[model samples]
Target: MSAGTGQRAAAPGPSTQKPRGIDRVLAFVERAGNALPNPVVLFTVLFGVVAVVSTALALADVSVTVPGTDDTKQITGLLTGAGVRWLVENLVTNFAAFPPIAAVLLMIMAVGVAERAGLLETAMRATLARAPRAFLPYLVALVACQAHMMSDVAAIVLPPLAAVVFKSAGRHPAAGLIGGFACVTAGYAAGFTIGSLDALYTGITQQAVAVLSDTHHADVNILANYFFTAASSLVLGLIGGFLISRVLEPRLPAYTATADAPDASESEDIRLTPAERRGLLCTGLVVAVYAAVVLSLWLPNGAPLRGEGGALVPSPLLTGIVPVLFGGFLLAGVTYGFTVKTLSGSEGVVAAMTDSVKNMSGYVVMMFVAAQVIAVFNWSNLGVLLAVKAAALLKSVGLTGFGALVAFILLVSCLNLVILSGSALWSLIGPVFVPAFMLLGMSPALSQAAFRIGDSATAVITPMNPYVFLLLALLQRYEPEARLGTLISRLAIFVVPFLVAWLGILAVFYGFDLPLGPGAGISLK
Candidate 1:
């Protein structure tokens, strides 16, 4: 029982009828999503919209009383001379200071070193080789879920690799591609450990929470959603594994390997050489030493990492997680790179870091627009005003509690179809919802957890995701005629179940009043 063989053995005969309803809906979604402007342009347009609305609101003297305060806050007009000066002064600073962009760029520097050294690919191959056939799908799903720690590296690497693994085991390669793509994109928010995304989202969440009250200015830990997301990874992996094994593979036409398919010998040749083995050993040693040092700074009695009054939540270790992540990854990557001879000297390491930043050129461009939009939104006070009004409306309609959380999840899930970037979406929506949820007695961490559920579940089926195109391109290698609809239809099967199961998990967490993460609970005190 080799890996993927059970899926090949269980393959059902092809069906004559098409799944018309799902196909139609997916086609419509694809068309509508593709019609949306590029994210950069979208953010630019949003910035203009915010400016116009802010001017109009200010002209109307629109004001909202601060919740738990008697003072009224008036909208600030971005078109005013004072606003113009503020914008000009802050434009560079906004882009330079945008937390997520900075964090992602820094993390990628280290990840790039590991990726260029071939450590990540080799590690994946080694892991797959050892995975039991009966649990191959589950293993692949788990690996894909965890791959978020490497950012887009998984999207670019996994689908083709999974296809190769399945094809070698006589399973439909497209099934493998879909399964890998599903977990990577659809389970994007669920990971075993904190990564760039946690850093990215937490920064956005903190900014949003800060707008409401200074007392709420506690720094959101990158691991704020750690416990829930760790559980989510398991659930997503299991559900994804089941769908890949039971539903997706059985329906696909039997795979006939094209010349374009990875050479069968490639999988056989994937063994780590002595040098690569040394690289892994060296990386592990370095990471262990780094972890020991970090723990020593945090775990001992009266350690410096502890917060004032010996609290952990606002501790220096949690607050300084981004730099710690950067340093840890940097050391691990350098160790592996040198061991494997991928890095000959400091020059090689510098090149890897430089290339990593070059890879983020598009993101950097998008962030410029995003930063301006966020700045204008903040200056206009529209986000605060909207949250205040929305909170009042929700209270009036009695939509608070678990039901409101459910609605919020559904809304963000739908929004995922049109907006693909999690950080971008969060930066746009977080201000409105974080405050509104807080007003309704939810913690920012809980609101963030709900956002993660919605943001991730629908990603696989959404054409708006930039990676879907990449997945489609990968699919074409096996199924020459495969269309966007093909991948969407295959991956869409898991989206509903994932959403339902994930929402159920959230409900249970709420019912039990479970902590979302260390020192982070479902409701504000």
Candidate 2:
């Protein structure tokens, strides 16, 4: 195929043209996607440029120091001069230290094998096609959330599939694309079915507490919101689909041009010859047995997944959740890989690992820059000061529970435009709010949950979301006229529903003093 010629398979027979509606909307989106700079490249360059400039200015003593701090003490910094090398070194170490990267690595291990074997893609498409119409949207949302359990699946998979789903449904393709992207990307932080974000945030908050108080008692669990979020996810997903169908669809304009649909392609469905099927089935059974064994460990009188002396909060199982997640993904991936021809032999597993790490390049860049930004802010004590002051201000106004949670969400949503990483924002705020709220009869788990809501709800609208701009590019494939404003405005209608529904669920959870998970309580007691 020529470079610019769009790929095609078997296009569905054309439906009646809605000349004044979806056609115009798709044209606008396509145009807008083409107009914007590649977001990944833009962010990568901006981050690199900012890091170099900031380091240089700090070295030259030309950078403006935040007031109330001694210029020589905070500003005559080494970020540029002697510090540049140190910054890079520290960033490397920090990147290494970030457990999420490791989780991403592990997930990719199995993921690559699954993909190479063609099992993953086939399963996804087959599942999509088989999903009931009434349940289709929720299934899409579920799959999108689960995509995070695998590395970068949403960015590479969902946009294209979304268009397919919409087109297949006789709805506007862009709407399906945008909705899927929104659910996957925006709800990135809320996958309580597994323990990825829950683990990262908990560790950060716990570390923050230790920094302030020097105590182990401050430990928070990664699966703190497991049940709460899993249930709430279903609710938010329903709201998401509703928003797309009612508000978002009406707001989008009719497409002026029809873009040819990409041909749906699938890898050879590995018909597991009966022997292979039994092997695969046995492998799955072994996994289930192993999982049951591991989970049973946490149910005993004082397991780590349990809180103190049988409690669930502050459980060691929760604290060390990253490794468990790694293990689960690794086991499943390896099981499927080895049992099926996908793994073929040991060499294939090694190749899968290699490919997984190779895909880490973009994340490596983002993390390197993100680490420097965070380290500098921390070193300067600026984040601490701001967080402390913010906490005090909120406390003074008697903000607590639902209202305070809402306010925090709003603040973080706005803050997302300037700072996007969940860990970065929480690292700054966790120190202050976790303890402050804990003192106000709230638990660190609840505080983190609130932050997550704020963090996720605005992700689709935030320019800082790493993948938001990628969606725009996909939009260009179908609608060449769409712009950032067009995308944001359409997403805005969802902003209210998401914010309200999420906050409302949280409020009820808090008001009832419900457990977010097995040991994850809404209150400190």
Candidate 3:
């Protein structure tokens, strides 16, 4: 809520400045994107399209030579007896075995409980309050850049928290809310820590790699892009903060209290209560104890968490990270909830977890369709065939190096306008990109890193994401006449800035032949 009555002034409207060239581009992009169907429907349609295409290719006797091997792979018609049985037998299994399903759910359940118990809210709010006012935007931007670890909870959580933080610092709340929304959605791959999203993206990437080669291939883990992404958080965070504070806020109209307007503070303070403080203190202890337990299990070469001969990357500790997060959040959330009376008993804890799962209902529906489409694509040999063809083309053009990487980033960025789900987009394209790049002696990690840039840079301005509408709603509180166009224009300003910064970071990493993360170098060699 308002830090003072002076802060109770009615929020002003969005800028009345004339539309810029970028605004028109965003408008056209938004219109084209809005014409597409929902992701679930899109994926279902894609499944049918893939089946028909597979049948056509099969009838045409299409096949490709597997790279680095003498094996010939042929397209199989999805309408044939074997194909029909594969689809029928694997439909349920496809969804059940989908790589991201269990991981996303485990993550959501844990983050949800922490959110429900108010631990996340209190802790983040405290962090925001302690920061210098001049650095508020940077802090919010940085926090948002990392919030995906909390999964979709970040979508619902960060905006309002940001608003409160901004209001406390005597700045326009809309800037914080809108800026936070932009950073969270667009700069998703920019984070200092690995979280659920890493699992979701890499899980699909691993599946794609697995389907590409019959022989053993390098596996993608949650840490595949860790090193590069952590650096991106700071770079993009500064750019975002500079834009929001210096450019956007300065353009906002003046504020004045109005009886008809909602209270800027709504009479709430961000400071934690005595109860919350105690709860947080208890949660800290829970975390420390959990850390100690993890260290005990990981320190020894013979530990179950360690890999063969105690390697880290291929170890259970790395592979099973989502569950590890689930356990930590569960311990922290339950501890705080019970301590604060937000959760009364065992039933309360279970209920919190249940509510978190409920938040994933829509995603579950989308995943079901996506799983089937990907399954068919792999089984029909479309991904492998495309990879071979695309790789051969890249090599022929003498562009199978950074030129290819740059082109891949641009392609993914353009597609991101209409394809709202990063996981969905990657699932569709990763199979092709991973194998194609591998054939060029580039690692899947490099391909994945390219995707991170492409997805986030354009995703910031896309009207296709449902969250954009939610962001528009939040802006309407400050600017009652605010429309999707208004938000789109604001979002447009950040697109190039984000893209340029990301490209710079990517170029540096690529030029230096740096590791994207542990054992995930830019080149396969």
lDDT string for model 1 (144-179, tens) is 888888787788888778877776666777877889
Write down the RMSD of all candidates, one decimal each: 5.1, 7.9, 4.6
lDDT of 2 by residue, 1-525 (tens): 121122111222223433445435534544554555543454445445545655555555553322233432333243455566666567667556654455545545655665665445545565575565556666676666555544356556875676677666656668777888877766766665563455556656654544224211344555777766776677877877777777665666774435444533321221235545554575568679878977887876755467666765456666666677667655665676666656767787778778867876665565555444445544443334444455567778978557787777898877655566676677556665775565456777788888878887777766555465677667766666555545666766666777788788888888888887656688765
The global C-alpha lDDT for each of the candidates, from Candidate 1 onward, is 0.81, 0.61, 0.81
Candidate 1 residue runs with Cα over 4 Å from true position: 1-19, 214-218, 480-483
Question: By TM-score, highest first, what's the ranking?
Answer: 1, 3, 2
How many pairs collide in each candidate, listed in order? 0, 31, 2
Best-fitting candidate, scored by TM-score: 1
lDDT of 1 at 438: 87
**TM-score (C-alpha) between model 3 and the true structure:** 0.90
- Per lDDT, what order, best first? 3, 1, 2
lDDT of 3 by residue, 426-502 (tens): 87788788888988888888899999889888887776666777766666667666666567778778888888899
Q: Which stretches of candidate 3 lie over 4 Å from their true place?
A: 1-24, 260-268, 481-483
lDDT of prediction 2: 0.61
Model 1 residue 362 CA deviation in Å: 2.3
